[model samples]
Target: MPASTREAVRTAVLADSDTRWKWGALTARRITPESVEPTGFVLRGRATPTARQLTETGVSDTAPREVTGAEFLREVRDAEARGEGYDVVVLALVGGAVRALLQGLADLGLARRPVIVTGYVGVVYEKLTDGLLLRHGADVVLANSRHDAERFRAVYEGVGASAEPVVEAALPFLGGAPHTPEAGRDTLVFAAQPSVPATRAERAYVLRRLVGHARLHPDREVLLKLRSKPGEHTTHLEEFPFQKLVRELDAPANFRLVYGHMGEVLDRTDLLVTVSSTAALEALHRRVPTAVLTDLGVREALGNHHFVGSGLLTSFDLLDRGLVPAPDETWLARQGVAADTPYEAAFDAARERVAALLALPALPPVTPYYTAETAPGYLPGVLARHRLDVTAPEPRESGLRRVVREAARGAYRQGVQRVAPVIRRLGEL
Candidate 1:
C-alpha cells in the first residue's frame, strides 16, 4: 500500500511507552498529522507493567491499550487475510525489542511492507547491537546524526547487511517544545544512571562524587535526577539505590537528589554531568553546557569511551574546583553537534528521507512465512531465543529469592567498588 502522495501514507507505530512518548509522539506530531490516521502497537517486551507505568506517567498522550507480540501478529494476519494493509510500519525501540518485532514480521511473511526503524536515543559508543534493522528487513534504518549514520553504514555493511536504506533522520525528540529561560543557571544537574555503576561500591563512589561536588560548590545547586525509584523498572537495574546512599552522606545544604522532567531541568541547568548518558547529548543540543564524567574512563558497558575528547567530558577535577566547563567547538564539531543550534544537523537532513521512503514501492511479501528463524514465540521466549548466541540464560528465580540474589550481588559489587580505588592506585603505580 505504498502511497506516492504524502496524504495517503497510512502508518502503524510499534513502540514501548518511553519510545512512543519520546519519539513516536514526535512522529505523530510531525510526520503524520490528523489527516493521516496511523495505528499504534506497543512493544510489550519483557515487562507489561512498565508499559502501564509509562502511560501512567503520561508517556503517550493519545496512546491506545498496548498489545502483546502475539496480539500484534494476530492483527497483522487478520488484516492481510481481509486484504487490508498499511502503507508503512514505524519501529521505535532499543536493541532486542526491535529485533523481535522485525523477526516476527518475517515469520508472518509480512516483511515486504515498507518499514522505517527510527532510533530512540543518541548513543555515544558501541552498544554491541549491529546491522540490526537491515538484517531483519527494515526498508529504512534511521540515523539521528551524521556520525551515527556513518557508524550505522560501516557496522551494517561490515556485517554484509544490505546498506541500501539506512537514512539520516532528525532526532524525533528534538522537534517542538522550545525552551523557556529559567531563573539563574548555577545548577549542576547529575543525571543518575543506576545501571552505569557495576557494583554497589561503584554506585556509592559515583554518588559520593556528586556529594563532593556539591560540598565543593556550596554556591551551586546540585540536583540528582533519577530515572527510576525503588520499585520502578527503568532501562536498567538499580544495583545501589541513590536514595539509600544519600542517607549515608552528610550532604551539603544545596545538595539534593531530585526527580523531574529533563526539559524542565535543562531550562534551569547551568551544567549537566553524567557517566555516559544520552541526556548529555540533549543538554548539549540545548546548549546547556554539559560534561561527561570520565572518573570510570573507557568502560565499554557504560559506553564511557564515547566521550573521550568531547571537550566537556571531564573528570572530577572541575567538580572539586567548583568549575563548570563549556562545550568545546572542536569536540562539538567532531560529534557533529551543530555550531549555533542546540539540535543535531542530521535530524533536519532526515525529514524528507523518511517521507520519501514511505512513498517508495511496497516490500515483497515473505512468500514462505515462519522460517526456522521466525517461528512464533512469546515475548520472553522470543527474546531468549534471539539472544541465544550472545546472552546466557538468567537462572529462573522470582519473588524474595530473586530480590535476595540481587542483594547478594549488590553486596559483592560493594566489595568490588571498595577495591576499585586500590585497583586504580596500583594501576598508576
Candidate 2:
C-alpha cells in the first residue's frame, strides 16, 4: 500500500508501570500493521516507573506522556468529538483501572470509539476470574497463550457473557537468538520479580540460595536481573528488594546485580533461573537453558506451580550439582512458546479481528461485566479506587494546581521508595 492511501492506525497505549508499558507498547506494535506506529501513555500512579526504569526497558525511543485516568478519558472523548480519535487503545493497567476506564468510556456514549485492548502483562496465575471479568468489555481481550485463551473464554461463558472478544496471542516481547555456549564465560541469570515471594523471609531465602550458588561456582558469572531498582516501581510492589537483601549477604565478585534489557542479558546467558517470572518463557523461546525454582516449593503464592508439568522446575541444590533440565515440548506448545511457531504469526488473529472491528460503521459502548445495575454493590468501589464515576463529570484542574499536584505525587513516590523503607527498618530495630 502507498503511504498516502494506507490507513494510518492511530494507536494509544495506557500502562501503569514499567513492565506493563513495555508489554503494552510492544503489543501495540505487534498487532498493528507494519506501516503504522503506536503512541504510549503512562498512567500516573504509585506504580509509575522512574525515568531510569522507562529508559531501561528500551521498548520506546521517546518517553510516553503520563496522564491520570480522568485526563486520559477526557482526551479520548474530546478527540472523538473532534473526529480525530485513536483507532486502537490498549489499557495496560490493573483490573480495577481497566474496569474504571470501561465504565468511563461507556459513560461517554460516543457514536464511535476506539477498539479497547487489554490483557495480562505476563503469566495469569492469580486473580484469573476477577481480572478477566474486569477486562470483559474490551474489544479485544488478548490471551498470551492457548492456555490463557481457553481459560478466558470459559470464565466469560460461565457467566453467560459473550466470549467473542477473546483473542489468542503470544507475549510480544518473546524473541532472541538461540542460546549458544560462549567460548570464555558462562553466565547464570536469576530473573527476579517484585512481589512473588511476598514476605521478607521468602525473599531473603531466595537471595541466600542465589548467593550460595554463586559461591559454589566462582568461575561462572551469576547475575541478579532485577525488574526495577530499589526506588523505582514495576508492575508490583517490592516490599523486599533483592538489591537490599544482597547487601546483607556476602556475594562474590562473579555474582553482581546487573540491570539492563533482559534480552541483552540473555544473549550471553548460559542458564536462566526464576521463581515464576515470564522471563522463563523468553528463555525457553530462545532455547536457553532455564529453571523454575522448586527450592521455594511449588506453591501458587510463589507462582512456580504454573510450571509444574513443564519439566523446568528444579531446586538450587540440583543446579549446584550441574543438573540442566530441558522443557517439555507439549507443555511449551500449550504455553504459546512452541518452537515451530513463528513469533510474527502470533498476532495474526488479533490483527484480523481488529481490522474487522475497524471496518464497522460504529462500535458499541464499552460494557464491562460489573456495571452499576448488575453489580450495584461491587462496581462503585472499583471505580472509586481509581477516582472514576460514571454518574458525574470528572473535575478539571488548573495549570498551577496540576503542577502542585504532580509535585505532591512525586514526593509521595519518593517516600514510598526511600523514606518508608528506612522507617520500616527502624521499626524492626
Predicted model with the maximum TM-score: 2
Q: Candidate 2 — which residues are off by over 4 angstroms?
A: 1-6, 389-407, 418-429
Which residue ranges in model 1 land beyond 4 Å of their true spot? 5-8, 17-21, 27-38, 47-59, 79-84, 109-114, 129-136, 175-185, 334-336, 339-345, 365-429
Candidate 2 shows a clash count of 0
Residue 297 accuracy (lDDT) in model 1:
69
Worst 10 residues of 1 by lDDT: 386-395
lDDT, model 2: 0.86
Best by lDDT: 2
In candidate 1, what are the lDDT values of residues 207-285, reduced to their tens digit? 8888888887778899998765554545444546688778998998998877655666677777788888777777776
Candidate 2 per-residue lDDT over residues 1-429, each given as its tens digit: 111223688788999999899999999998865426677789988998878889888998899988888778878877777866778899999999999888787777766677889998999999999999889899999999999999999999999889999999999999989888979878999999999888888999999988899999998899999878766778887878888888998788989998999999999899999999999999999999999998878998998889989999889999999898989999999999855778889899998888777777777667778877778999888887988543457667899999898788778877987788779889999
Q: Whole-model Cα lDDT per candidate? A: 0.61, 0.86
Ten-residue stretch with the least lDDT total in model 2: 1-10
